[model samples]
Target chain A: MAPPSEEPTDGAVSPADYRTLCDLLRERTGLSFTEAKRYYVQRRLAERVEATRMPSVRDYLNLLRFQASGAEMQLLVNLMTVNETYFFREKYQLDCLVNGMLDEVVRHRRPGERVRLWSAGCATGEEPYSIAITLLERWPRVDEFQIELYASDIDSMALDRAREGVYGERSLQALPAELVERYFRPVAPGSWRIIDELRESVDFSLVNIVDPAQVRRFTGIDVVFCRNLLIYFDDLGRRNAAAMFHEALSPGGFVALGHSESMSRMSSLFVPRRFPDAILYQKPAEGAGA
Target chain B: MGLVKAGSKGTLGTAPTGAAAPEDWTALLEHADAGHRRHAAQALGDRPDAAATLAARLPREPDPAVREALLTALVRIGSPEAAAGLAPMLASEDAGLRNGALESLQQMPVDAVEPQMDALAGSDDSDLRIFAVLLAARLGPAERSARLHQALERDPHVNVGLTAAEAVAELGDPAALPALEAFAARFPDDPCVAYTVDAARRRFRGAS
Candidate 1:
């Protein structure tokens, strides 16, 4: 039977209803939305609207607001907060790593010691793989050190994809042709699977950044690239994660945050070290305090 | 060795199992390693009963990391007592500790923070009073307006009054027009206050 069309017949969410939704979303998550972002908001809301089989966005709003279980709210948040991660996303930090940071990192390392790099929220393999390829391709002495790369995400499904290490054009658009040819093999039209060597190079795991126990697994990491993820957290959540990162890092390790994020708000555990291209935070060398 | 595959050990370590008792965690709050002590604070934060212990350790905590862990734990607990514990840091002479406390308090919900507002408003320091108004404004609209109006009406410092006036104006309360006009009279010669009050008048009347 056809459903009754009692609501706004076109399934449009009124402006006031949209504002209420944005306000509720802002309260629950720290993310902000405005009229300029209505298209983005509505597109995601439409997916949930259809998935729930709700007649219109207004009723979907009721499901989001009044539902005691808050399950659908979580589903909406997951969708809304899904960042479109791509390879070499923000490469200046990578440049900083290759040119100067790597030299400084190896300065204190003993011969045959492993240097660990962690991708705290590596969604779909782009970030960690980018780092690996940059080291192999850019750093002149890349082969001299035994580098261990670790990538993790709270979402298991994302980790699964990262382990599979396959990508489409969206993820590969930033890679240089030679690097792409050297690293990836064509799986299909417009699809490439990272060569088995690179796939196995990064160890993908599921980790919730805020959970101390979960975050404690990797100690003595030399570099942590946690781009764009911490910005979603509230102040306390950010601080909690920062403290965890600080504890997990080795004495003189470095943290690279998203371009928009500053160490100032996160924690005072690390001192800001400015590289030629980007700013990074360095945990003090031993015998010093932040 | 080149980029090694998941080591002889598995890719990731086993999930962390077992939690320490609140007492165990609390005892370790004074651990020598800042990392150990920070973890203790994080563990106690999960215990709603440990708010006072976490709060008590906050002022004496010299390490910024440990102080952060303590403040985060209190924020996680979010009890009224936790709010009260964090409130005194508003009066701290140390900018880092005081600012950390303010940021942490801002993360708390209104109910958790409501009881402490009076103490903050009555603080001898005017900066604390201004911070109290800002904290009140972070509350839900109904409470935010009420507390901000209270500050506008009763605060002695011109700076506090001005901040309250601006915050109330932002709330766009219809009744705040007369309140703003009265506030302008209190600082008869101060152009900044006069300008702010005038601006708030237009906003309130326009909003109404």
Candidate 2:
């Protein structure tokens, strides 16, 4: 076997290799690398090329095509996705979710009806746990209603961190003191582990949002927190994801996006509703029909 | 014309190697399986001649994944016809498609995409104009300054003007200073527009 080159022949992916990897990455996951990220992707994946002992990016791509077992494919997915998230990263949006979204849903909910919420791209579990904390604290009778909270990410490693529910102090910066005290127990120096019941309330899974079939499994969800996820997708990916969110939501359910994202630009399926503190999308309530 | 058949081991290389007739690859787009269509679509990017053929097939393309592949091919074709076909997609209801088309157009050579600009900038639609101004800012300093100037002065849409001001701030064009001042003066109380204009002025002035 040819020894792995200390450096890529050109220290970059060839144009063809870039295209091939991009196509596969976009297909397997909704995540896309912008032109600016192309060079970054090349440098990041160079180690994989070395570890796999491929001669060039082309060779590595060829392996992905003809010979990759699921492990190699998963490795590529893990390398390309950006999973930077923290507890309460965007507190204003969470505020909207707790104060406005849940408030409206609770008022309209039928007796014993569980309020279902999904945190798509819930990297490292910060988002979902944050949601659970927000619900538990804000909803006066939250325990009285059955609550189904699902959190998913394409990165299995991140999901593992999320599953463990242990977080460093950095993830707690935006979290209010009261919520932290109430919801977590000290685990180590400057670290906290979520209380067991709070952690158990959320169901975490590996989900690629671009896969229509996988997304189809979720239906009648009352709220979806898919913030900061769609910004990376290309237009086609964004459109498809929006359609999927539309399909997954129950009538009159809400979808909250990152501050910079807007569903109006992509699809008419959701109506833009401005809350006192934030803007969100709501699937239209069903009409009186069969 | 070059062609790539995704995953054909016999033809596999850094790029899809092995010269197949262009017709053969284009023909594969008609196949029922999404994977085949995706492969063919990715392979045909270098064929500007295929733009019209690909654009025609876009609407009926049921699968979003296949549609994405087709859009990528058109953007790569970078022909005038391809740019024209791509314009409508910038306004697609899907944020992904809108962003994809916008990014693809931004990446295309200025000369190649210039043909589609007039229709976008001159249109009555504010969204398209906003998109056009954002795109123009990426076309290098001179062109960006020029478009930003006209957008601030002449674009009827306030949102478009506001977007232009933001792009000006991002580019920090010294030449745009006068326009930025005028724009800020035009909307003194409109905090959103004023913020971008003031920011651009500060950026350009600081650079000077």
Candidate 2: Cα lDDT at A126: 92
For lDDT, the strongest prediction is: 1
Best by TM-score: 1
**Structural similarity of chain A in candidate 1, as TM-score:** 0.77
Which portions of model 1 miss their true places by more than 4 Å?
Answer: A1-83, B6-19, B165-184, B188-208
- Local distance difference test, each candidate: 0.82, 0.76
- TM-score for candidate 1, please give it: 0.79
TM-score of chain B of each: 0.85, 0.82
Provide the lDDT at B167 for model 1: 85
Clashing pairs in 1: none
Chain A TM-score values for every predicted structure, listed in order? 0.77, 0.92
Model 2 C-alpha lDDT per residue in residues B43-142, reported as the tens digit of each score: 6765888887787667667665567667767765767788777778876786656776786677565777887777888888899999989788767667
True contacts kept of 1: 0.56
